[model samples]
Target chain A: MNNRLKILRAERDWSQATLAVHLDVSRQAVNAIETGKHDPSLPLAFRIARLFDLSIEEIFHDQN
Target chain B: MTKIDATHNLSESAPSSVLRKVLITIIGGLTAVFSIAFLAGYTVAVTEQGGLNAYAIGTIAAGLGLIGLTVFISYKLWPKGTHEAVPAREKKSQHILWAAVVIGVLLGGYMAVASGDNPDGVFSNEPVTASFAVISIATWLIIVPIITWMWWRTIDEHEADAYREGALVSAHVYIFLAPTWWMAARAGWAPQQDPMIVLVIVSIVWSIVWLYRKYA
Candidate 1:
């Protein structure tokens, strides 16, 4: 899985830590998701979607 | 910059950040040394060896060398002043965990040194004074459970998942290992299994896997 999390954060001028705080997660968690080492759970995905005011599909995409 | 933005600048090279790096390096180095020593001791015990052999020395040397390399790399890569803001509640939880770990390691080291005269070292069958036994039991049976419960409750979902995966892998290893060692002992092909050694090995495996999942 790949996501535009880094790009999204950068667009908003938000550091990983800033986004992590918004999501109530560790910065490491945000980094892992951004790097594709971890996939967000459904609830987290929803949160991320809500945060960016975009659908989950707009933020995250399957590699295939 | 906003307050949060101020906290995220890694290029500052602040005095506080320098102190943090030094502290991290010291703690990480000590942890690596302790882990290696603990594993080496158990390896010798499990093999029924009398002393450190060439292999043990080589392993220790390699492990220390690796630790040195890791420290160097971490130092090089770490930002000078870029610690991200952790929520206050989560920060408190982290402090408690570190305090517990430090206490545990100190107590363990004290026990090993104090039991120097005992043939079986810290696990000797020799009777301890009543007060010592009470203190030890209280720490292990009461304080440990409370701390463990707090730890489980405080960790985030990612950490919980890492712990679960680590436990699963270690449990499988133990399931196969204990039985094989027992059967071998029965057939006079190996020494009897020691529960303590088995526990240590399993714990090490769990820690390794958990760290990998969390960081890698």
Candidate 2:
């Protein structure tokens, strides 16, 4: 999975820690997702999308 | 730059994702070394004593030492930036540490009875063979269930998948410690020497194998 989490977070001027707090996850988790090292679960994906007020497809795209 | 903006800038420069692998490796390495040293010392002491009692003390000491080392390392390596990315599995790791402590204390108490060598206490010198037996049974029952519950509750599907992949790469170095600990206690390989030596050898061998695979 590839995500624009970095770009989106950058635009919002939110630190990973701050974003993680909003998402109720550890900062490491947010980093993993942003770097494409990890893919969030459906629930977490929805949470992220909701936080950014964007559709899931806007933040995450299928690499395949 | 404003402090809030500075925080954002720092977050962008080096994201939290990069640190997970590094932290796991460091922690795994530390755990491996600590297990080996403590087990070796324990085995030697047990061999001289010629009983299960010595083995118990050695195990307890090693468990305590590892906990101390973990705390020290965490304090020293306190990473910069927010730590929001911590996986839920980290909670299981913490619980495991507490479980280890509980096991150590219970075992130590049992050993004190088995050896009839209580240094200072009202029960000192009292024959506690039955008490030791009962306690040992109880401890085993409690520890296993607690570990199972913790694993089930804390490890999500994703973390479990990651663990499986990482375990293969590390040649199961991290997983071997628990089994080795159990074997040392249950196996009657050498009654006099602490069986923890077995754990030490296992950790060393695993470490070597992990390094070989990693570097080669």
Candidate 3:
């Protein structure tokens, strides 16, 4: 899965750690999602969407 | 809005990260093997030698007391009403779990060897020394599992994934190792493999891989 997490985070001038703290997760979790090494769970995706004030579809995209 | 292209950099960092993970896992696995084997052997030697002195009793008491104190302190300091990760709390949980495992194994192994009457009288497991049985039962069956559950609950999804992956690798390792080991022993080319030793090895391998994958 590919995500616009990095762009979204950068737009708000938020570091990965900042995003992770706000999301109630580890910085590693945020980095994993951003690097496409891991896809967020449904609840986590929803949390991300809520954090960025955007829909999940707007933030994440299918690679295939 | 212009994209900053942060994702592209992950590819550049990934190979090095993978290599580091592999290296750590290998190192951790080797460390586990040596530590576990040496402890198991030492426990055997101690039991064969027989009588437990004041030093052994004092060491056990002091160690268990210290662990209890540490666990209590960490639990007291745990973040209140917050579901977020607390690194210190998690580390404490890890420490508690390892202490339980190592101590439990050593004590249990010693108790097992010390059990029953020794013809040599180096250490006779008389009726009065039956306390080893109770300690073994409580520590191995009750305390260990309870601490293991507590430790398991403290981890997030990523750590759970790492554990699952590590377990899978260890399980596969056993499937190959045990049968080959049996064949080798049967052929008289190798010493018979101790089930306890093998179990310890599997656990060590799993932990090493799991920890490396989680932290690295």
Ranking by lDDT: 1, 3, 2
Higher-scoring candidate on lDDT, 1 or 2 = 1
DockQ of each: 0.22, 0.33, 0.22
- Evaluated with lDDT, which candidate comes out highest? 1
Question: By the TM-score metric, which is better: model 1 or model 2?
Answer: 1
The list of candidate 1 runs beyond 4 A from truth reads B1-80, B123-130
Ranking by TM-score: 1, 3, 2
**Judged by DockQ, which candidate is best?**
2
lDDT of 1 by residue, B76-115 (tens): 7555544557755457667777767676766665554444
User: Which of the two candidates, 1 or 3, achieves a greater lDDT against the reference?
Assistant: 1
Q: Which whole-number lDDT from 0 to 100 does residue A30 have in model 2? A: 68
Model 3 C-alpha lDDT per residue in residues B80-193, reported as the tens digit of each score: 442233345445654775676567556634543454233222123245355766876778788778887887776656667778989999999899889989999999988887
lDDT of 2 by residue, B1-216 (tens): 876678766666553334443464457544644444455445555656785675587676767677677667766665654444444455555467456655654465445334532233212333556766687677669866777577646654444445445446445553665565566657864334333554455545654443332222
Q: How much lDDT does each candidate structure score?
A: 0.71, 0.60, 0.63
* Residue B57, model 2: Cα distance from true site in angstroms: 20
After superposing candidate 2 on the true structure, give the runs of residues whose Cα lies further than 4 Å from its correct spot. B1-5, B8-137, B155-158, B166-216
TM-score, first chain, each model: 0.98, 0.95, 0.96
Q: Give the local distance difference test score of model 1.
A: 0.71
Error of 1 at B140 (Å): 2.2
What is the TM-score (0 to 1) of candidate 3?
0.58
Candidate 2, residue A43: lDDT? 92
